[model samples]
Target: MSFDQLASELQVRKAASLYRGRKVLQSPQQPEVVVDGKAYLAFCSNDYLGLANHPAIVSAFKQAADEYGVGGGASSLVSGHSFHHHALEEELAAFTGRPRALLFSNGYMANLGTVNALLGKQDAVFQDRLNHASLLDAGLLSGARFQRYLHNDVDSLTQRLSKTQARRSLVVTDGVFSMDGDIADLPAICDVANHHKAWVMVDDAHGIGCLGKTGAGCAEHFGLSEQQLPILMGTLGKAFGTSGAFVAGSDVLIETLIQHARTYIYTTSMPPAVAAATRVSLKLVQTEQWRREQLTSLIQRFRRGCEQLGLSLMDSPTPIQPIMIGNADKAMAMSAALRDKGLFITAIRPPTVPHGSARLRVTLSASHTEVQVDRLLDALDQVK
Candidate 1:
């Protein structure tokens, strides 16, 4: 495309209020942050367990840096797989009760590699309409016939599966929908996949380390086993409070990905220190049950306050509580108003969400106190 055409497209985006920008964060991932020289109480982070800035995690990273230097220095096939990476993979497999697991640089690469490795032009991939953009992009790039069912509707998925005649069929979904913060009906979806003779793949990036008894993610949250959920993916950047992502499943599935997944085979591995730090974070996620409990209490507190304020909240039990604001301009105004009140919540606008569903995405973390939540509620009330 010409430069003029690109400029015109940018103008069009700005005219529609759909243009996006980033805030320069000068602080670590915590309840409060300094962005672009301004400090605010933030409620938009993915650090649900609040271990992102924990002392032990930081110490682990520093210690590993002294031992392993900074980078992986090569792809895994070319000797980039350090002892830290290998141990984390093994620990993840055992934690999820899977036969094996493979780590990717991040969740995007993991989703892309897994889908492309499994499906081809002759196959069909069915997904939830509300699946993450990475999953949708992966399906489109896999050269497969892609179809999306209604969000969280097993019947819609079943109807599509019944008519599929591809050589192979795969069902893909988010264990927890990222935007809406609602958990998928995994049991029903898995049952449907089984009856249709299809494989199920769930990217539980937002569910791990928050849901379930042992932080095994959505599969554990729903009491589903590896047999029922044959393909599972989780990230360390969120609740695990580190970088990198992993795909866990049968031994054969992982081997296939290692051989065929281009994203995994070609990209440089993650930093060794990140893997080492994630190891410590993993241990904390297991041993520190109190963090999860505190998070739950905060979530309840916020929800109760929102209810009293008559906010248009979605049916989400997770920390991701989005207050529905129907118009783009209104959502932006609300976010700006909250910012003026010293609270940091972003306006999630289309095409991130559907038209007329723009919202303020408020997230809770274990490190947040009741007073902070109440303060946020007070800010919301004042802003609205």
Candidate 2:
């Protein structure tokens, strides 16, 4: 096939102000970073607890690399499942208060593997309209009867569940809506699912390591038991300052995924070094309550500043605070203006979000100081 159609499609995207570009980070993931050789106060990282470069995690990774080398070298089902991986799985199972946990290469794969492993042509999968792309794609690719309900609307979910006659029904949702930064009403959702005799799964990728008294995530925060929320998926990269993902659930669920999930069965496991480092990161996530406190304090400060400036903000209590800009061009312009002022916040546009709802996604971290947040507010004020 000729490349003419692809070339024209690229041009169309650029013309619509929906084009995306990447900036090279010359430094580590932190508040102050050198991107493409320019220093900027960045607020777009998912390192919520600010442990990406923590000394203890670094040391553990180094030690594990020396012992296990750099790669898994094979799929887990073959020879890649190392001791570090096994230990982390057990730790995660206990952390989430589930009977067992299975590790995946990443959050995308985790969602794909879990959903597909549990559903088929005779099954039904219900997802939130605003779930992460992976979850949506998983539901579509599962060959199940897939339906999307209104975002976090229990009545909508109940109505759909009541009508499905599949052999099995799974209701999936994000513990925290990534872009909007609002939490899922898990309790209400669980109640509704139970009423319909359906299973509930929560992808808490952005909720863990920054939520709950023990940083166990939305499940812990909402006090949902393993039976209440049967399937739980969480990522380590976001707040744990490491890479990979895990699904914690009943023993049967983990075994089912291990036996049937192609994404898990076919892919090489995550490096042992990362698993080792995550063990350390997980400890930090649990023992360090100050990180969550700092995040809460910073979020309040930023929201108060945005209110005073009269900027349209979303109803979010998490680190992600988006300033709503209805036009894509204006949102891009505002992002550029902030960059010019030495602040780096990305403007999220469709099809990542709905059309006419483009906005600047501002993520906070414990590493960010109060002065740095004020500087961001000042830059936003100027741009506005």
**Candidate achieving the largest lDDT:** 2
Give a tens-digit lDDT track for model 2, residues 1-384: 799999999999999999999989999899999999999999999999999999999999999999999999999999999999999999999999999999999999999999999999999999999999999999999999999999999999999999999999999999999999999999999999998999999999999998999999999999999999999999999999999999999999999999999999999999999999999999999999999999999999999999999999999999999999989999999999999999999999999999999999999999999999999999888889
Instruction: Give the lDDT of residue 174 in candidate 1.
Output: 97
At residue 382, candidate 1 shows an lDDT of 86
lDDT of 2: 0.96
Best by TM-score: 2
Q: Assess each prediction's global lDDT (C-alpha) against the native.
A: 0.94, 0.96
Q: lDDT value for candidate 1?
A: 0.94
Cα distance off (Å), candidate 2, residue 187: 0.2
Question: Which regions of candidate 1 deviate over 4 angstroms?
Answer: none
The 10-residue segment of model 2 with minimum total lDDT is 374-383
Clashes of each: 0, 0
What's the TM-score of each model vs. the native? 0.99, 0.99
